[model samples]
Target: MSLNTIDIVVFIAYVLGLIGVAIYVSREKAGHEKDANDYFLAGNSLPWWAVGASLIAANISAEQIIGMSGSGFKIGLAIASYEWMAAITLMIIGKYCLPIFLEKKIYTMPQFLEQRFDSRVRVTMAVFWLGVYVLVNLTAILWLGALAINTITGVDLMAGMIFLGLFSVAYSLYGGLKAVAFTDIIQVVLLIFGGLFLSYTALDLIGQGNGIVAGFAALTDQAPEKFDMILAKDHPHYIDLPGLSVLVGGMWIMNLSYWGFNQYIIQRTLAAKSLEEGQKGIAFAAFLKLLMPVIVVLPGIAAVILLPELERADQAYPQLMNLMPVGLKGLVFAALVAAIVSSLASMTNSIATIFTMDLYKSDAKPRSEQHYVTVGRIVSFSALVIAMLVAKPLLGQFDQAFQYIQEFTGFFTPGIVVLFISGMFWKKTTANAGLAAAIGSFVLSIVFKYAWPTLPFMDRVGIVFLSCLAIAVVVSLFENKVQDNAVDLDGVSFKTTAGFNVSTVAVIAILIAFYSAWW
Candidate 1:
């Protein structure tokens, strides 16, 4: 799987060009400097397209490209539910959630909790978010990306990981979210083009008669079992997909957590110039999400026909690159790197935001905006360093990185969702209940995890979500009737634009058509 000179040359050029673009977009006018608002939230001035592009660029990274492709090889198209479901989740957030957050003028998710509940809840979740971003999210992205680079170019895995970490810092640390957001548009274009080509190459160029159509036909005919949209209870992979739960159950919790609440992900939407801009950005991302399976998942399913007997499912994507021709192969590899580095930058940038805004700002005395921005840079760099050191050690052993991410993250998502629901809608919900929901979500999940091991985690998540909500509700009722901090939605309309409505219907129709055909 050696890369040709052209492939190497193209990837290098893309990296350099991306860095230049980031620097250019991030420059402040003379006598103005990068301040906290400017650095962290792009000064609240991103356009819809940039926000949309940044959202996808920050998301469809090494995990989706490499890890989920591995799942496609192992679990088939059933794996695409995560992406498909997310389109719906993004719409829900845009219509119902983003307006509130934007109206509140918040920078981070933890900050929202602070405003809605208390500093106790904010600090509790801030610590949890920082840990997850660094330990799980950052480490997984780096290690899995390094593994893919190793597979394609024979680059040493550790060396590849280090290069990726440094590469992200080179572009994003200086400019913060503005640089990351603007440059992400290019990364996404590459990701989509490269991913689609790789899938096509796997089907058409790898000795299949005719082209991609023929290759796809071969996959469906030869491996009909791989095309199921939902797993059966008796299916070997049922524990992973867990039948209908991928649609009607825990998968929603997962999507809501990632799209609506996660600081690292929602940070892009929070940076929009206005509520309308953010929702439009979300609508744009929803359309892109509908296309993601074609780019990311299909390649793995294609691998089942093209390269069936691999040691690991995760290897399916990188190994498929070995089948591609020279110049195009480099383009695809660059695309892969684009996803990895974009996410790395986005994650580190987010880690800095939460640390600086929720933790540092709350504790430290008032300081110059430049001082906080400097601290943010230092924190971002430190997060990258910490993640690089711990990545392989924490994530090296997992064969299918995507499922590991879902399973581990599942532990806390149900509880977080409960807290948010209570904070926003339930007037009687107390800070104690919010704090209790936070702890109770984890404790109950642990109980379900070990005590009821056979419960499919997707099901487990749904049950735990209900359980946590109940716990929070009961606790809230016992303490008080509607707390003063509950959100006042008097004039806040959840009504969306007609354009957004049309987009939502289109997405829903497409999802319906997709599931029906596959089912």
Candidate 2:
């Protein structure tokens, strides 16, 4: 669909504004002579509010907006399970996990492993995450975003892909985590507004006379098969076996490893000024997580009813956007850009952080802040180039994107999380045990993924995670305890006013439940 002049202008204006923010932030970073800690970790000074917004912005991107909506249109409301379950996972992290990281004062997830386990394990896991973060996760999103833009506009796919890569690279290279967090605040706002608009517009098209429940009923009647939650046992298209394997057996393992351990998400908690702030931020993100189904998933379901002849599920969001009146169309496009850029910037900054702290500064003589910042720019530029090249090959396929990127993360995350929990709480979990858990889990997941492709992706992840948990438990039990190096979690304060604000959480929870019921 070709956009009108106003739509084009609005898109250009929004992009320019983001570029301006990036340039302004870079100047600030330059002025305040910053250290590696300040550049890489945002000085551990981001308040709870910023942390909350940034986390949501980073987490909700083209994957959720484009990929998620596509899944919803094809599979019905079951896809919303991903967003809702995240709330429960965040609560677990805030209550049980944040205290340990805050107390230990670790920068990267790998660093935490080093202290809990050994250097060999830390390096192994570090290399693994670095590869996944850059190659699989970031690359897929970048390509998908470019594909959407190319489909919507007349721009060349390769050129659009390169342009986006450069834009994300420049800002992330210069502003570090501070820029990523601040800009993400704007992104989250735009994304929420854009999504609500699409939902409202779609419902309006269905007819202003009907309430949300009636609107959904109308859609379901028009396309009864799309609303089918249980894939027929004998149906060839039914993924019941895979779905059952993925949903029951694998999802928990994946979520636990991700929300519980991943560095990109956890880095926000690490940057918090205090444990209270971290917990507050996590809880806030949890509340926002509940809204995703309405904004991203419901719209997809609406698309199925509204445009029954549409060939591709991934085309749903853009097609809906094309139907919007002029002003609304621009805003939605801007929000999509915001979502994509926030994720890109977050990944770029994290890659630089891992390189600077985990790889560069660990052994080399400590360099000046200016020198480190220079290296950061070079590293970001280099990574962006690699991601861009990878994005070209990632276009068109949605199922492959999810499985290829997510399944492998399970192996390392479960093992790392198990070790971290044991390291903090149990006195018997030695460094050797942590190392063993990580190595064992990594090898086991690879075996599971290739050896048993029919076993459902999520179930395999669950098996690997559980296996790691068991190995960590057994190994830690047998390993010798450190005589004097044992960590003390006693001094860490959990009584602060940082716990989940029940009222706010309750409101968000109610809204999510109401929407799900209506759907």
- If scored against the real structure, what TM-score would every candidate get? 0.99, 0.90
Tens digits of lDDT, candidate 1, 190-295: 9999998888777785445579788888878888888999999999989889999988999998899899999888999999998899999999999999999988
RMSD of each: 1.1, 3.1
Residue-level lDDT tens digits of model 2 in 389-508: 877665455542443455556656666666667777777777777777778877887787678766555566667767877886787677655525456767766554524757346745
- Worst ten-residue run, lDDT, model 1? 200-209
- Model 1: lDDT to the true structure: 0.91
**Candidate 1, residue 86: how far the Cα is off, in Å:** 0.6
Residue 405 error, candidate 1, Å:
0.8
lDDT of each: 0.91, 0.74
Q: What TM-score does candidate 1 get on C-alpha atoms?
A: 0.99
| Worst ten in a row by lDDT for model 2 | 237-246
Best by TM-score: 1
